[model samples]
Target: MTLFKVAQLARTAAARGSRSYSSGMFTNAGYEASREHARGAVETWKKISLFVALPSVAIFSYVATKDELAHIHHLEHDPPKFVGYPYLHVRKRKFPYGDGEHTPFWNPLTNPDPEE
Candidate 1:
């Protein structure tokens, strides 16, 4: 028989004061109550997931759009300087043959003293 028909029979038997009928009715009622609780829990979880997901999606979208916003606003930034060994040494060295050609290093004979 279908669950509904079984529950109906159990209820009728319980009303007649039969021990067997009482047990069946109580079991059916408990099952129905548990099912309701499970459904409510699932709904609660769905609401919680939506709350969590919406903010995460909004944050990700905002981060992704930052570059586009910067481009539209014509934002410019200088390139980062290299902090590693070779690049640091290269930057520190003054090019003797370049703009400052009169520096002592460029004319070794004029400043023969190495300390100079």
Candidate 2:
């Protein structure tokens, strides 16, 4: 339609969109209500985790491992010697630095020594 009518319509639309139901000023009542709700939720979740979830997990773990624990036994003999099979323990090239005999973080308990 006319430019004046279009401008008036746009102004009216913008005013309606900007209108708010709540007061623009901050209020202590709103802050207190939100804080109380958040505190109650935190306490409820803490109680559920402490009294319910933790104990349930502990009981489940114990029951599940009880049979395995009873049957567990250490090996009577030492581990088998590392037979020099090309495909099995393939060490293509030695390390660039250090003695290059064993890995940098080699643990005798877990990892077998190359010389063994």
Candidate 3:
């Protein structure tokens, strides 16, 4: 679902909160009721987010892990389709400042994968 739809659902849930704030100090039952409502809303949002997030995470991991495994297995073939989003790696190259041809510009040992 869209973000606006999610926001609308959250707003609706918030509107359903039990008891209204009065000018006086909050009571124990009122606090309990408010907490309960908030907890319910949180639980609902958690389920929705998991449903949306888990599959995408699985797909991303599958594509990434498969590519890494392919490399380890001495397979020089290009990774399968969907392994990378289009133009995801299209960025300006950063060359070394000096003409130190002996030095590698980017060090994999020191530079962590941007994906991580």
How does each model score on TM-score?
A: 0.35, 0.46, 0.35
Clashing pairs in 3: none
lDDT string for model 2 (16-108, tens) is: 878855662358887788889999999999999999999999999998798555544221235445566657546688777777666688656
Which portions of model 2 show Cα errors greater than 4 Å? 1-27, 52-77, 87-98
Error of 3 at 113 (Å): 24
Please estimate how well model 1 matches the true structure, expressed as its whole-model Cα lDDT.
0.63
Ranking by TM-score: 2, 1, 3
Worst 10 residues of 3 by lDDT: 74-83
The top-ranked prediction according to TM-score is 2
**Model 1 over residues 74-98: C-alpha lDDT tens digits?**
4334323334454422335555665
- Rank by lDDT, highest first: 2, 3, 1
Q: What Cα-based lDDT does every candidate model obtain? A: 0.63, 0.73, 0.66
Model 3 RMSD in Å is 16.9
Q: Write the per-residue lDDT of candidate 3 for residues 8-97, one digit (tens) a residue.
A: 999888887644545332688778888899999999999978997888899999999998886756433432333455765455654466
**In model 1, where is the ten-residue run with the lowest total lDDT?**
107-116
